[model samples]
Target: MLTQHTSTCGKSTGTSTGARPGRPSCSLTQRHLQRGWFSRTPLHCPHRILSSSQAGCRLCSGKKRQYSASVRASSAAGAADLPAPRENLGDRIGAFRNAFWKFLRPHTIRGTILGSCAVTARVLLECSEYIDWGLAPRAALGVLALLCGNGYIVGINQIYDVDIDTINKPFLPVAAGELRPALAWVLVVGLAAGGLALTAANFGRTITLLYSLGLFLGTVYSVPPFRLKRFAVAAFLIIATVRGFLLNFGVFTAVRAALGAPFVWSPAIIFITCFVTVFATVIAITKDLPDMEGDLKYKIDTFATRLGTKNLARLGTALLVANYVGAVVTALRMPHAFRVPLMVGAHAVLALNIILETRRLESQQHSQLAIRQYYQAIWRLFYIEYCLLPFL
Candidate 1:
């Protein structure tokens, strides 16, 4: 007879005749064997053969190892499915700032700034013997109001011409998808409202009325039902009126009001108004030169399309030359006290520059790049004219 031993697992370690004595066995061991959980060398419970505590520790350690591996695999899969981190606030803000700057059309903004400052300075010089430093704040406020109006005009034009811009100015914010149309519309409306409020609150009636008229012209120039930009003559007149006549006259009136001086149409104002009106017409014409493809595709009639690029370029150059000549003759006629030499020299030099630029464009066969460069040069001359306005 063989002695039988009972393990903590509650199975007898007894065998029948011809079986190995003390070989551990249990129902749990049999299940492990069927599932191939144990080694193939023997039919025995490895856990049962050990002391109870030691067997429990080994089994627990095995389960812990298996659980840890499963957990690690699950974690890796989840991590792989996770979304990428978001852009930080600073980066998002910087992108929007850049886009907004582009949306404002920096060149046009610079022109507005220079024109406002020049008009304000000229008015101050005319009204007072010494510069009134106190009026600087008011002048700046007027500039801001004008800038808001300018932004509204350009912003609305961009909104309406998004499709046209995709072909002509693909880098524009709205056309490039850098700005949403709804957001752009909101900005434009806010700008218009802000400009009106600023003008109405801070300026006299003449300034307010002129500002209102400018805003109206700007609205009709680009907005539907009166998109005068589609008509060559109307577009030219509108641009010349708002950017050339209205801008200078309004700023001059505002500054004169600030100085408590009665508004007078000085020779300086008249000269600048006429000069810039012609210049603005040139701008309106050349602005469409590089955009001819888009303008034609969309049936937006412009001077550049009516007169071919080369012909229009000649026309702009001829007009600019005539303008400079007129300035030179006018400067000569002015009394010696009016800085005649500076005016004559500046106009003469500008006339020469325009002639040279035109020749270069012609030599380049009026290619798109040449046309764009010419347009940019025209704007540069425009800036220089504003700088000279105060002296006049």
Candidate 2:
């Protein structure tokens, strides 16, 4: 027989074949007790077998575990109920503004402003007798309209080129996830519409006509079925026509119309047209150098892809050198019109810099940087030449 009773304090005082007094006791052998088997009261201990001396131990242990689990669960629930930390208002505003600026592409914006100023100054300085002082505000409004149009042009390009830009210029707003496609499309459409409206309102019909044409060309350059960017010859012609030829031609014509002068191609206008066309050809061809990877992936037949890289670089460098030489010759020919010494010296230095940068493009990584730097330097030269145009 197994033990079925114990003293009141759970001390083993005797062994008996019958149940204990006042409470039920299980008669179990050492093996059955170790295996957690209870004959009379299975409810007393399901997980843990207990001797007659330790009747209610399982219940007490289960209660402690339940209490611990409840405490942890409540603590977790309380933490989840707390509010999250808030972002600063100023930081949020600043981030949004930065993103919007990147979407505009500040370099091109600067180019538009400089180009407009050059045209205005040329008319104001060279043909002031034709300008009505009362219509000066109209001219300023026309510049603003042109800027909006320029933004639309570039914005659309970014929208279409976002995939390529992710590979070539990942920091751009559209490529970097800072701007959404819908937002980019909205920005371009709004700018285009606003530009057309403003041009029609303040500027004359001539100015409005030219602005509309430029906007159309920009649309054709990036939009599907007519994206001229796919073919090297077409891309070259488009960029050269728009940026080099039309930009100067349209601006000069518009400014002359604003000044109440008949549109006439002055010697100065002809000179700029020819020079910019050649310079723009260099820009058109060389721009593809750093963008080779993206262009190749997208099957864009640029000058860099069609002609070898070394040949493209050499061609671009030679053209840049020629441009500088032409600039020096022009300055010398029209000393009465330009700051001759400054123009000559600046062009010479820019030419030398182009030569050095092109020569440095031997390694792939270095070539990318050198080509991009040269491209940017060319823009800087463009800006400086525009800044000097009023004097001419």
Candidate 3:
């Protein structure tokens, strides 16, 4: 006969049929089984014969089902908490933009824009009454044309200097393999044509001719058969003529012509041209200092290669200081033309910076860094000159 156990789990629960006298109490066993304590055990009824392994009591079976369901729910929740992976559109666009800007050489672009703006501002100031407000868009287009031409010149320079640049400026587009030569040529040609066309359509013969001449010189400076860059003197003259004389004078003249005004040689224009010419000469000569290795390897006769780095540095430093000094003197003498105090103070600050930078260049560890920074500083001064031109 089986013992009928009145347990807490349920009434009329059967006791273990094969239980020994010293086994756990029936009530305790029922409570443990109901709580899923025997969940890991094989499917069988604890109260039935031990041989009947297929027989599972309802309470234990329900608990086993509940445990499996909880485990599946937990796994599903964990998966839901984990975020899915995806690409960021903004990051990709930013990367592409940075690469394109670098390829364009941001420093040169900045100089081109600032210089064009300066000339345009000076022209407008000088011939304010003559300028038609309707021609504002045309003026904007002219500036864009100038920028394209400047880009073309720089692009061609990089294309031809790829080999030398690999050693001297490996980060440049061509040398770094970021821009293909064929594509670069297309850009150059397109920019050159667009620039000439825009100038001819909007401005007149004076602007167009000057732009064509500048482009011709730039081509001669870089292209084969008449690669002026191979000759230090030719390169220096070409750079100085285009940047210092042609750019300032031609751009101003062109703007004035667009306003139907006669070209006038103002004191400000003369002073600026002189300053830019000297500045460009200094830049042209000193630029070779950092590229000495590649220049020597390629038999390029740069100022630094011919004159030596130390001599070139000293000469450039002196010339730079002199440029600022001259500017200060010009400002003081032509008080009616320029803000005397502002111009004098600006020049004095630039001269002092060169003095400080020269001292830092003496330190061997910091020489390379200081020299590069000083080169950029010269460009900053050039940009600042244009920014202040409106005041003058």
Candidate 4:
């Protein structure tokens, strides 16, 4: 008889049958394509719910079927051991996802479209209130440049730091051998091409400038003696300043051009851009903190390495507070509008996080978590604020 296996997915009795009638087999062997999620070092299932099927795992609840690998092995050992009918399809789908994910993995690509694009959702939404600010299509293209370019730059940088990341980020795609350099390069090229193509597709002339800038920064950030990372101060300026400006430039140009109108920067527009820049700078600094050790060892003179963690944290906190105060000041000075109060409330949360976390991390050991929180706080704050844009 073929045995049935039971697993948990919020308790409905998880059963997968691979055996014939009568008798019991403990095993239900199936091909699993999710090596990273399901079969990592110790292997961890991310969601308690039925998340992605890529990392399929066996269940052992023991009701109609008991967990018995031995019995199933004996029964099905001589069996074909071939890929299940659906497994092949799942693998292909997963490969497709992985390719896209690797190309634009700004937010890790498990959910949402991508990080760069998502970040601008709120900004674009707000800008839309004031101006025609393009729509999702062109905004998406700019985000593509940011996401894919970052991927290219990071991937190429990883090729250089394989040994460094091997020890520091053991599970990093490159470190763990999940992504190879050759394959990564192909993705990088494709994504960059896609970004440029999307620009040419609609936003033509304006896109030419922005795309070139994004791509140039991507190439120079990690390559050559100009390996901009070696110069921490300059690196900080490049990423933070450039990214913040590009976000505004992209939406402003696309929206204005589409509407066939000249762009006007109102107090409201300047406020949002400044807000984005300050917060982006703060988060960028926080990211720099975690790489302190690697930066110091590798001669990377980041803010944390040069200014020291204590000072860097203070700087980050200062920037966060400045962002909050700026928001408040702008809201008060601006004409009466619901967007002002909402933006203030959203940024208030981010400010609180900065005030709390920055004071606590006295040293670099806490960098990993601190850095992650930086991103989470940024996004949560963004979503809250951005959601208000459409209402206004």
Best by TM-score: 1
Question: Which residue pairs does candidate 1 place in steric collision?
Answer: none
Candidate 2 residue runs with Cα over 4 Å from true position: 1-90, 130-133, 331-343, 362-365
lDDT of 2 at 364: 43
Q: Please, what is the TM-score per model?
A: 0.78, 0.74, 0.74, 0.65
Q: After superposition, which runs of candidate 3 have C-alpha atoms over 4 Å from their true positions?
A: 1-99, 364-366
Give residue 336's lDDT in candidate 4 (0 to 100): 74
Per-residue alpha-carbon lDDT of model 3 for 1-392, expressed as tens digits?
01122232233324444334443432323334344433434433345422223333434343444444443444455555557776599976775566557767788788778887887888788888897999889878988888888888888899999999999999887788867788778888898999889988987787788999999999999999899999999999998998899888987787787788976788888888899899899888887777888999999999888887667877888998999999999988888988898889988998898777666666554366666876777788778888888776
Candidate 4: worst-modelled 10 consecutive residues by lDDT: 34-43
User: What C-alpha lDDT do the candidate models reach, one value each?
Assistant: 0.81, 0.73, 0.76, 0.56
Clash count per candidate: 0, 0, 0, 4
Native-referenced Cα lDDT, model 4: 0.56
Task: Identify the superior model by lDDT, candidate 2 or candidate 4.
Answer: 2
Candidate ordering by TM-score (highest first): 1, 3, 2, 4
Q: What tens-digit string does per-residue lDDT give for candidate 2 at 1-392?
A: 12211222122334332323333332323444334334333424333665434533432443444433433444455455557678799977887688778888887788778877786777767787876878778777777887888889889999999999999889988899988899888888999999899988876777678788889888888889899888888887877887777778878887787777877667666766777778778878888888889999999889998887788888888987998899899889988767788878877987888787776674544466677876787777667767766665
* Candidate 1 C-alpha lDDT tens digits along 1-392: 00222232232334334234544434333233334432222323455443323323232344434433433444455555557799999999998899889989999999999988887777777877646788778778889999999999899999999999999999999999999999899889999999999999899777888998989998899989999999999999999999999998888777777777876788888889899999999998889999999999999999998999999999999999999999888888875535788888999999999999999999999999999999999999999998988785
Tens digits of per-residue lDDT, candidate 4, 69-178, equal: 33334335434344556657888678657644543444423212332434344445545555453455656565555555556656666666666666655656666677
TM-score of 4: 0.65
